[model samples]
Target: MDATLFSLYFSALVAVYLLPGPDMALVVATGASRGVRMALVTSLGIALSRGMHVFMSGLGLAALMAAHPVLLDVVRWGGAAYLLFLAWQVLRADMRVDTTQGAEGSAASGFTRGLLTNLLNPKALMFCGLFLPQFVAPERGPVLLQFVWLGAILVAVGFAFDAIYAVLAARLSRRVRSASPFRKWLLPTVFVLLAGRLVAS
Candidate 1:
């Protein structure tokens, strides 16, 4: 097993999770108004959707790399470019928390929303395709297995961290309402750093 590769994947995953995104914000907002049960259900749906993405990416990447090995560089460069683009968007974005859309809904509805929200985002598929391939080494065993392992780690980590965010948002709804400007810039900075890391790696 490639411990070093796994470490890099883990670090990247953590950085990405830390950045403010629509999905995270939605989970937090849901938790704040709807409570833990819905938040968890929503998170489960999100996690499942991510798992589907990773599985599809694994299959597609493994096949493509097997046929066109040089495409590895393409995935790497593409991922880096995408990360840079995201960083630019974040940097230029207005960081305002919208807390007005957290109506209490059924667990099934929350799950469906979360699933559709993730599956509908083409960026998520692009992200998995780009990011997962970076850690795969042809010298290792089946590339598909490697992808599954790495993607599983990513999903597990993201779920845990997002769950914590849900609980915090729920417990501190009032404080979250009056959130400081620190988060606004902090997440953008993190995105910039992540983009740099993607390039440097």
Candidate 2:
């Protein structure tokens, strides 16, 4: 990649990562509710999903989805439904009590939630398809190689941001009382809002 183009791409990536989105909301919620370990696991799941999106983009799945609007709607509705399910889970859980049956199981569920949350969103895949191509330069190297490099960078930067948010949220949660209504309701509210946003979009 050309040095200047790479710099520009990096700048754009940073800007995008800084924006508050569902992924950030999910990470922060998980951190605040369950603690840093679960949040980190969630972030890892999201990173894996992002990597898969990049791979699918490389295979031109984005174009396929664009050609088939029905497919996109299917993903969009599915994502929204999943978000609502997460919201329900949050609402029903008693955060004041340590009701978790097992740490390992809880972590697994968190990872699955994070992975599915991002993976089910058609917009995220479409974004990978659109954003990655803008930075690819055929003159600099093989196009596929350039895409791979760019995709790797995108996932790395995104994961870094998510990790930071997770840690900060976890630390903040420690200062607030566990019985606080705001602490209990925050994740559910965020999930519902995200679901609404996905449906609206």
Candidate 3:
């Protein structure tokens, strides 16, 4: 593995993960309703998903996808469409009591959603595709292994640190449950903003 690339990827992941974004919001939402366990599970899902993205990008899948102009267009549009759909769902979140046992259904879906979101994310593919090549050297132990290690670490660290964010968000969700006036406006607006971000990107 390339030590330098690993270090670079680690640092970049830390900076980017800490930024407020869809991933963070998802952590907050899951943690708020399902407790820390659920939040962690969701985080794991997201982490694994990111790993998949790195794998695909590093293994030439991303380039191959990009090679076919029609396929690239499909993926791009598909990702955008999914993001917009998620944005609407987030925006329309019910401020009323989360009376349902979300835990019953949230586990797999949370993980899957996290995974699929990253898999479909064009930004991730593009970033890794472009950035990874810069640090990769022929002397590296194994280029593929190096990429995997870098990507895996990035996701794992993200998972571990996100717990803190999830705890805070869950607490906030609890506190705000009774304040529909705040939730109705805040949550939906954030979703709309996230949607806009997806489109803009």
Alpha-carbon lDDT of model 3: 0.68
Per-model TM values vs. the true structure: 0.64, 0.92, 0.75
Task: Give the per-residue lDDT digits (tens) of candidate 3, residues 132-196.
Answer: 67666668677877786667676778787778887787787777767545544554454355556
Q: Arrange candidates, best TM-score first.
A: 2, 3, 1
What's the CA error at residue 11 for candidate 1, in Å? 0.7
Clashes of 2: 0
Q: Pairs clashing in candidate 1? A: none
Per lDDT, the best of the predicted structures is 2
C-alpha lDDT (0 to 100) for residue 169 of candidate 1: 74
Please give the CA lDDT of all the candidate structures: 0.68, 0.88, 0.68
Deviation of model 2 at 154, angstroms = 0.6
**Cα RMSD (Å) per model?**
8.8, 1.9, 3.5
Off by over 4 Å in 2: 96-100
